[model samples]
Target: MSQPPLVEMIGIEKHFGGVRAVDHVSLDLFPGEVVGVLGHNGAGKSCLMRILAGAMIPNAGEIRVNGSPVSFADPNDAREAGIETIYQTLALADHLDAPSNLFLGRELKTRLGNLDDARMLAESRKVLARLNPNFKNLQDPVSSLSGGQRQVIAIARAIYFDTRVLIMDEPTAALGPSETAMVANLIRQLQSEGIGILLVSHDMHDVFDLCDRVVVMNKGRLVGAHRIDEVTKDDVLSLIVKGELPADWTARNLEAAQ
Candidate 1:
């Protein structure tokens, strides 16, 4: 039998005063798989992601990790459950170096009751090497690093804590070709280790290239879910613009319903 998904958000709902930002939506992320979430701005993608990241609570829904029901009070609660989110901003302190930023809030302390710089540096190197072998300058502040390097730092911090589910928002946004390739390699590496990833991105190329499955949303509701190989860009675009599934998709549903 197949194992349960690493994470499942079922029938999620969210509202802002009189506005319904997210309707009843369900999504799942499986181990060693990448699921891409696509939608235009104000399409409720961010709101849904925030709920999954524990930055916002759903007005109604259920969240499960490893088949067990969970309720996240905050981002820390999500982190404790092995869920990590790397927002678009990267969320790294510019003045801090890789080791410092990696262990910013969750610092390692020595027996003498002081910060363990040595241990932190060693741990930082190990994680960075796993993601970016060319990564050096562990002591240099993040402000001095390039965009890709800074992204590496953010991703490293997320996975350093035994992360099982990673939510990345616009991970390769504004990155150059080479930098984008580097991040892509790191994503593949993570998948090989059985870590499930939920990627929310506007870039269609990235979605087609990296994701195993694509889930499209429109007007706060899920339009459809499609396997990467089974659907075309036009099919996804039709869903985004018209909120209608492709003819083939509709036929498949009809066959399944009979």
Candidate 2:
């Protein structure tokens, strides 16, 4: 049998007024795995992810981190537990440089409580160098950086802080192919270092190329999850829209068996 997941959710439910944003969703994420959460508009993907990141509290559920049950009171509470989310908007300060953005709220301080500029810069460079050696000039304003570079800085910040589980919502939604490829490579690097990633994406290509497993959510409910090797994009999309498995998936399975 496979090892237990690094993160597990049991009976997760979240409500906004009378509408159930997330309905009895259960998920497991293993270390060094990328699990894609794919759904169309209004499919509750963000709601479920926010709950996992503790930006939004669940009305009912049990969360397990490293096999120990836990509850989070706030986003900071989740951060303390190594859950980091990079939202679509990126949540980065445009006026700040890469190092500044990396250490924005969690700035390093000297023993006397002054900013430790050297330490933060060194850490930022080290993280970037590990992910992208071509990255240069951490002092440039993020607004002046290319879209892909900005994404790199945001992701570098998350990974550098030792966040075990990174939730990236539509990380490549607004980028060109080359930029997307860069972000995709960075993702692989992070996963190779044993990070668990929950990726929410509308792009089938991104999901297919980067995810080890695909989870489909439709109408606030999980339709199915299949290992990438077990199914095709068409099969997962059918489940996303119709809440039904592709008619040929069983036939495909049978052919593979023979």
Candidate 3:
């Protein structure tokens, strides 16, 4: 028998006053899967991810986590459901150090409710060392770190927290090639630990290289979903532009898109 999906979004719909921002789109994300959602600026891909992250409420449709229905009132609701998002801006406080940023708004505390300084620093150090070996001194101000270093801190914060489902929005946008590559490596590490990932990116290479599956959106509707092993980069691009599968989708993908 097939495994139950970690997340299932059925007939998800959202509107902005008179405009429909997300149409009847549905998606199933498997455990330990890296699923990419891609499309043009107005395709509603971000809207969908925002909804999945519980940043917005869909006008219609059902969202399921481990097959149980969910109503996400906000991002915190999604986080409680094991979903965490790293926005394009990353939302890190540049003035804070790595450990401070990691524990922002959710600090570790002792039984007496005193801030657990020793435990938080030691634990953050451990997780950071594993992912970015060069990282040291979690107390240094983030302004002193490189772009990739800051991104690493953001990703590490999500992973350190028990985030089972990670949502990354345009993670490498406007970064240098080296910075982007660093983010890619971080993603691979997250997947190795069986975290389900939803990656929203503008780079095709990032999508093709990092994701197990691709879900395309266009003009507020789902165009197609392509398994990375069964489709080409060009075919995924076609779906992004044309709002449908390319003529050459594998038989299985064609059936799935239909």
Which candidate has the highest lDDT of all? 1
- Give candidate 3 regions above 4 Å deviation: 247-258
Which one wins by TM-score: 1 or 2?
A: 2
lDDT of 1 by residue, 182-232 (tens): 778878889999999989898898898999999999999999888887677
lDDT of 3 by residue, 81-111 (tens): 9988888777789888888888887899999
Local distance difference test values of all predictions, in order:
0.89, 0.87, 0.86
RMSD of each: 3.0, 2.0, 3.2
Tally clashes: model 2: 0
Candidates' TM-scores? Answer: 0.90, 0.91, 0.88
Candidate 2 per-residue lDDT over residues 114-140, each given as its tens digit: 999899999999988876788898898
What candidate 2 gets wrong by more than 4 Å, as runs, is: none
Which is superior by lDDT, 2 or 3?
2
Worst 10 residues of 3 by lDDT: 247-256
221, model 3: CA deviation in Å?
Answer: 0.7
> In model 1, how large is the Cα lDDT of residue 102?
93
